[model samples]
Target: MNKFLFGLLLTSCSALGGNSQYVNPFIGTSNFGATHPGAQYPNALASVSPFNVAHGGEQNKFEKDAAWNSRVYIHENRYLTGFSHLNLSGVGCPDAGVLLLMPTTGPLELDAREYGSSYSNEQASPGYYSAQLNKYAVKAEVTSSLRTGLSRFTFPAGQSNVLLNLGLGLTNETGASLKWVSEQEVEGSRMLGTFCYHDEDVRPVFFVARFSKAPKTFGVWKKMPRYQNVEADWIGYNDSIKPYPGYRQLLSGDDIGAWLSFDTREQEAIEVKLGISFVSMENARENLDTEQPGFEFDKLRIEAQKAWDALLDRVEVEGSDEQKTLFYTALYHSLIHPNILQDANGDYPLMGQQGVGNSKQNRYTVYSLWDTHRNVHPLLSLLYPELQADMVRSAVAMAKESGWLPKWELYGMETQVMVGDPATAMIADSYLRGIRDFDVNAAYGAMVRAAEQREHNLLRPENPDYLTLGYVPVDDEGPYDGSVATSLEYYLADFNLAQLALALGKQEDHDKYLARALNYRTLFDADTGMLRPKNRKGEWLTPFDPELGRNFEPAPGYIEGNAWNYRFYVPHDTPGLIQLLGGPEAFLRQLDATFDTGNFDMGNEPDITYPFLYNYLEGQSWRTSRRVRELIAAHFGNHPGGLPGNDDTGTMSTWLAFSMLGIYPVSPGMMDYALFRPSFSKVKIHLSAEYYPGKQFVIENPVGDLDSDKPEAFTLNGRSIDKPFVTHEDIIKGGVLKVK
Candidate 1:
């Protein structure tokens, strides 16, 4: 740790007093081309876990995406639309926050990509986003929750009217319709929100948005590719978000015109608060009234900070300036979602096959189970076990109502996106880590159903190729026609369940799942000695380019990525994989080769766990050190798009987290950690007496004996545990670690 950075670290921690403010949630705030608004109030999101400041750019809510990207509004996305809300902290895919409202006057039209304007960093903030609508000369600021946000526009003198267009296309490839309830309020949210990229569930999406400023002239418009058809839903009532979604001649991708013009003063600031509700507009209003009453910006800001403090306090860091900055930033990313979906009184509309209604519990949002199951959730369970249990119970309850466990469930819909039975992995890992607070029977049922069903079953398909050939081959006769990714994910998940079941005393189920855990071996191409792909009859794909994408080679590799990424993805079997790679020497060689060749695609998630594999190779300890140091320094920069890939709601940053702490969780259901080189000479994990009374994870550098000019070294609990590897139980129980 450099002295300058380290000194800055001291003052920053000192300011936090009992909690930390060292984390600049705004760091990655601009990354992915936009900054995440760690300030807005989400009733469902526990608090603002501001981990990174990587830039995406400034927006309305610090997090909410705006009309057109202010900085770089390039078509085909590829960067950002300047929108960031109901967003995963770090993951790569884009999801919620639809109905992008832009303020324009004089013959309002649609076609957002064209109508939207651009701005610079000086325009955005937490809970507020401002940009000069290039064409209209209007300055706009936007803010919101997963369901609703408010836009306050200061119009130029000529146009006092504010515009609200439902046809302004957003993500998810769906259009929205507006029913003019009053001059100021439009009763609707984004219609048919985006899918979970993987196309998981096929449920209609709906949200009711109540705007603050009524328009002098307000009406609905249908978006046409080139223009718009402004219409009026005059006498009709917008009952709620439930029944009205599919019953209309709503706008299309072509109909891009809708606007609400409201008269305003020249020097006037019209603040529009749009309350969103999954169940009803009444509920959205109720949520707004409870959390954010009367636009008191200061009050909201304080409340937002308080929420962030509560979560950041879960762990504490003491290190160099840069190290602490990275630490707090990583910590901030950790709590971005699984947002609080219910109202203040504890009620939320469930997104299920049964459709719109209040949930059994406070339904959570921002599920990155596929990305987070590995470490993010595990980290959460380790600190906030009670919350982990609640989340587990929430998953189970959703499964009970929806028939099958949803992949990426949002309000009343299962956007079956992403691969893997991650719900199973999360539950299983939580249970194994001592976070068993759900219906054991129901959880096991979901777990078994996911693993046992035929591959074609919508809820739980029996994987024929997975069952027969041990991998998903292109030539396999189908029921389930997907990628090898699902099988690989299921293999990991099933293994976790098997271990969890064994611990929970479900013997038969344990044995069944245990057998399923070995399914990864089917894809293990012994010829290449790496987990590769094959044809149905067990023949390797011809001219298989492990680096090629799925569409080209299909089942020869997993979905979304190549075999190189997935090859070392066996978290449950590092030792087996190490052995398969020929031993510690060969394992180290191959891992080195993966990185040395620079083919590890830091731009993806599969190989995230790969860097830490050196910990298992006994004598080859330094490799882990080198890789950890290099990865943290290279990909995790302090800029937007600074990420090697989608933060995966924080999985990547969480990887930074463990790396910064000098440890990483290699197994989903295991409590042990594969060690690495600590970025600082010392790091302390704050422990709670409630969960872990009289406990803490203390890392004291072994090089403490050296002078200030000398380099730093590590030691654990006083004695240096030469080589790598540690356990969750070790640190949480609090023993002094001397790494000097």
Candidate 2:
């Protein structure tokens, strides 16, 4: 089918049925967006992604470095190493592209440079991927169950081989053990930690791999140590990871792998099933037997597609083909993380511990709370309320097991990557929005603990000083000097905690935290009218520049952002911010100037909500619409480099999805959505019955030109409303929001 016809068919199908057909997984796969066109169910444990960006291949085009090392294949890279199971998508750091399976023919070679091939005829959907290995004349297709990955490879007539390159992974940590379980099965474990180079609390991931057909011959291979001449004596250096042919029953080393050769005719196909677990190899096999016992690739693929379609069908929108594709793809990316971390039998690794625990419900990992707390969690609460509730439960469980709330959790381990106590905000927001399935008191206690604990609190490293000084002071000589940004994040977290406390009838705690939440006032430099760095004695830092932070450069007191971005970050108290900026007139002027002068950083999270701040002003809300439309057109599109920046575990994509739907959760721990002109002609959100009273909520823009900045007369359920905002309660009550 031609591109035009395929697009037309997708449009027709979306118009008549579900909208999952419009999802193009290829978007955000290049230009440092770091997304992959992998195959996985929404929030599933296992994903099968093309592992093509690694070194040691003639067709490999990318340089081997920290910048180029990613979880899976980048769109620009042009080599095929294998199909790796357990991959992460849209993450800035590399981790968890492990358990590689590559199919080849003729002479057997263990090195990726010798055996790896170039691939073409690539195609991917929500839960299915296929590519043709041009060098080996093999067709590779992959699909997945919740915990298991399934791959079917069609080989040309000859001696075909499937290589399980356990040593070749996408992580800095190396060390693996492979043992043959039977003639057709294998079980092993691989070390997969050091997320973002933290190195602490590394954990082993065990796997069980089985073949549908028994191999004619099977053996193991290891990278032998290179001989180094030392004073005329040859000494072996283990650093050289070159493949050495071996048939050992058990191979355990940094660079060791297994291979299985088969005698087959032309177009012969064989299936490989792999199961993964953080606990043990037995649980890995259990997961495989429980989730996917058969070799039915088509069945699993279709079932995975249906699962995605069902999830995407929750929100129906009518729009242009491009708009629909972008909307669904963003939604797809938003559901790929906070994955189910427990095995089928409910066994999971204990966070920061040496033991394992069992849970009745699925434990979730890969929190990335600092990023997802902005919009991703809010969107999930609105759309997938039950899943959101489970996520909250998982967080509470993690805190109870690990002694603290997660900052950047991965596989039950706290990575401590990014600043802020965002888990509080995420849980508070979800509970306030009525998705209260977890222990609220326990959650509140966890937040209080995080707030009070000074030492060993990863979320707030400067807690004691912040509590005493009402702000984190700039440290001229210390390594941790992101005081302004950290203080601002703490204020936001405190504000959310205050809201939760107020709702739970803890008036004293509410007042206490609310007072602390006003610490943003201390950072404001009235003379310059911007939030500047303050010393320990409440003195302003000299020679401050608002636009100094750009191109990933470090600002004096900011984290990955500048003053212009963090200045408008007081979302909890926008009125106070406006007051500090010399009232509404000056506030609007500065806000407009931030955009007019190109000081706004759309790719950065601190300023993502700046465009939506116009909705707070009465007449200037039109500017919000115009700026949002312009940003969407310029930064977001339907291509490989569609995203403006790192997806940040779908926070950026969630922003795009919400923008397209005409509503954004500008404030975390708040129930209301700031309204904007939606790109679609109509949008219908099927509210989850478990948490919401309404069955459906509709937003309709009958006007054809959604790009216009003019305000339309708005009515909710035939009642006129003046404000450009809708509360979560209002949405759950079910009504038509007619914009004319």
Candidate 1 lDDT tens digits, 1-740: 23244234333423334344455444443445233533344234322221111123332334244333322122112212223223344434444434344566555444344344444322222233344555666665554443445556667665554444443232444554455455544555455444534454333233334455555655555532223334843443321111122223343332333355556667566765555555555676676666556755434444444655676666665565567667766766666556666665566665465444455555676576777788888888776676676677778877787667766666556766566788888887887766655787898887777776775544435365566656666664232333566667878877888888888787997888778777777667767766665666677667777666523244345666677777788888888877777888887777888788665866566777887787777655566667777877787754444456556667777888888776778888777887655676666676756566546676655444312322224456566676566777776677766543
Weakest 10 consecutive residues of candidate 2 by summed lDDT: 8-17
Clashing residue pairs in candidate 2 are: none
RMSD of 1: 7.4
Residue-by-residue lDDT tens digits, candidate 2, 27-118: 88776677888787889989998987877444555655535376487776777788889888778888888899999999788887778787
Quality of model 2 by C-alpha lDDT:
0.85
Which regions in candidate 2 have their CA more than 4 angstroms from the true location?
Answer: 1-17, 56-58, 66-68, 230-248, 476-481
Point to the candidate with the largest TM-score.
2
Error of 2 at 657 (Å): 0.4
Task: Assess each prediction's global lDDT (C-alpha) against the native.
Answer: 0.58, 0.85
Query: Model 1, poorest ten-residue lDDT window?
Result: 238-247
